[model samples]
Target: MIPTNIVVHQHSKVLELSYDGGAIYKLPFELLRVLSPSAEVQGHGPGQETLQTGKRDVVISSLEPVGHYALKPTFSDGHDSGLYSWDFLYFVCENQEQLWKEHLDKLALAGLDRDAPMTTKGHSCGSH
Candidate 1:
């Protein structure tokens, strides 16, 4: 179900997705960036996923709709490719805690932290 309202709370760095059923999800910008569905984040195939780091302070510069399916959020750090589909976004809202934990685990395994400077070199959206 597509959200009835999408509010980007820049001060708090959260994206609020409100549904018709009154479900509201406050997703952090960092979480969104890390979980972006683009190939840049998910890669072209299994086991090729790139670990995103140092995005704790990332903010949404803008949110652009894509046709009738997803949103393209331009991040302050210059990332503007991941297409957050309705299905994916709903999944994110439903499993936010688990997804966040997984992201943290991945970061830890890579010896990285969200607060660190983004230095891990890897593709991150439509080509640079």
Candidate 2:
């Protein structure tokens, strides 16, 4: 289900997707950044997922279409690896509430705060 229209609201920090049925979904920039499907965020496998912090003010610097199947967004933080497919975007639109809750839970469990800055001390690879 490809979106009929896609708009990036810089001031509000949301990516709005409108479908054929007039259903519109607004995904926050922070949500998109934290939930990015790239290896840097999702990691190579399941448990290796990295917890994204200090992304509350993250913004989409640019958006590029990917072969008519997905969108690649360059975030203000310089992250641009995630390719958001139509299906994945739809799923995200539908499950944003639950996803946000889960993210908050993870942050709490990790003794971290949503607005905290990302630390490089534990990331020995220096990939981030």
Q: Which candidate number maximizes lDDT?
A: 2
Q: In model 1, which regions exceed 4 Å deviation?
A: 120-128
TM-score of each: 0.90, 0.94
After superposition, the stretches of candidate 2 with alpha carbons farther than 4 Å from their true spots are 121-128
* Top-TM-score structure, candidate number: 2
Per-residue lDDT of candidate 2, residues 20-92 (tens digit): 9889999999999999998778877779889999999999999999998999999999999999999999999
Model 2 poorest 10 in a row by lDDT: 119-128
Per-residue lDDT of 77 in model 1: 88
Scored against the true structure, residue 106 in model 1 reaches a CA lDDT of 84
Candidate 1: clashing pairs of residues: none
| Tens digits of lDDT, candidate 1, 1-128 | 89999999999999999999788999999999999987877888899888888888899999999999999999998988799999999999999999999999988888887787766664554555
